[model samples]
Target: MDAAGLALVLATLRLSTPLGVAAMGELVGQRAGVLNIGIEGLMLVGAFGAFAVGVATGSVLLATGAAVGLGCLLAAIFAWFVLNQRADPIVTGTAVNLLALGGTGSAYRLLFPPERPIVSPPAVPDLVPGVGVFLLVAVLLVVAVAILLSRTRIGLEIRATGERAEAAHNEGIPVMRLRWACTLFGGACAGLAGAILVLWISQSFVEGMTAGRGFIALSLVLFGGYRPARIVAGALLFGGANALQFQLQAAGFEIPYALLLMTPYVLTLIVLALYAGRAHAPGDLARPFVART
Candidate 1:
């Protein structure tokens, strides 16, 4: 393939980084027995928060930090409902997405009013060689997360807490605290992904800008069998499909454009159907652990 084709693939990988990170993070959270369904909404909030802070402060770091903070804050609410209040995680998660949609839409309008269909926007920053940088970062992050999830004591504790909280609790593990920590970590990753998108690609906060990548990421956890390396492969596969579609469109091939847009999702559904029963989820996957005899 030519350099242009290589670039296209690389760019697609970069674009998919945030989703990959968020998906892997969600995998960690879910592995511990918690069902967090509000990832999409959390991502939206993170995207908006990062963009608003980045533009105003002109510091990508600050914007990203704020986004992570917001993601964790939002996830806290989810943790409360599912972990403490013992509410239906699915319902609470839906509420989070709806809330994010309304909140982001309103915040964008109120903070940066439109003028002739244009809002006050800053340009997205590009790396000197955009695709190369994102690719390196993606690789490094995958390695780091893999080490964190599988090779460290904390990682083991995290898995222990998620897989069997009550059992871990009996063994003197702080199940609740460990769960909260992992969820917060997941949220932070989601927020960081948002910041990357806002600062490098989208450049502005839009209503529901995260699209449905959050949900896709959640599915990716199991599809990847909770393995960090596998998750990266999964991400690359999906991202490759997206990149190919873009190339096809640019090449002016005779094809229904809609198929390109839906390719990633269709792949996800297929993976879910094929792999759902094979993956070993946490023992208490969706069950709230309380003081039970």
Candidate 2:
């Protein structure tokens, strides 16, 4: 491939890294019968946590650790409310997003005063000559999740829970426990996704740096039919669209940049229109499991 082609490929991989990571997590949650839209919030706070830690400690590992812990922490709160309190997942997810937005914005202002220049944090060093380390991490994670969900006993139970919670419970599977574990795992993925975004892609915590990638990842869950390999493909497609937009703008395209910026979302809508109702989703997806007396 020519230099330009190689550059485009690298850019697409970089852009896809975070989306793929987060979507894998979402795929796990969905397979375990939980629908969490708060992934956006999780990613947002995760970005903040990574940025703060990287700035304070100058350690990429520490930053990523902080991001993952924060993501899991927030996901635990959301799960407690949804699974334990019987709250609506959609409403709870929305509230989580709103809270992250407000909290991150406030924290950013306090840490990065308007009078000072915004500085990008130290990035995690590249793993290869031309590719990003996080992209490699994402690929490994996708493979790991695929194996976990397809070739393990826990995988079987998770699938059973998503397919029929009542049956799984009657068969002695711990339905609520499985869901909680899946939710927490998903949150950790989102946290890692946030780390990839700030430490690798942007290298700074812009308020709302996630930029709807969480929603896009949610769509990828459906777009890929809730499969890890397909989710990674969907993420790559969306990432390519985003990269193409930037490339075109750099090449001085005459079209409005706003329209270019909408490429990924527009493609998402188009794909959904084409494939809606065709994918096989988990039977118990998005339905809270209430124990019967």
Cα RMSD (angstroms) for every candidate in the order listed: 2.2, 1.1
Model 1 whole-model lDDT (C-alpha atoms):
0.78
User: If scored against the real structure, what TM-score would every candidate get?
Assistant: 0.91, 0.97
Candidate 2 lDDT for residue 153: 97
In model 2, the clashing pairs are: none
> Per-residue CA lDDT of candidate 2, range 218-242, in tens?
9998989888888888899988888
Q: Per-residue lDDT for 223 in model 1?
A: 85
Runs in model 1 deviating more than 4 A are 116-128, 132-138
How much RMSD separates candidate 1 from the native structure? 2.2
**Which prediction has the highest lDDT against the true structure?**
2
Q: What are the per-residue Cα lDDT tens digits for candidate 1 across 191-214?
A: 767766776667777787887888
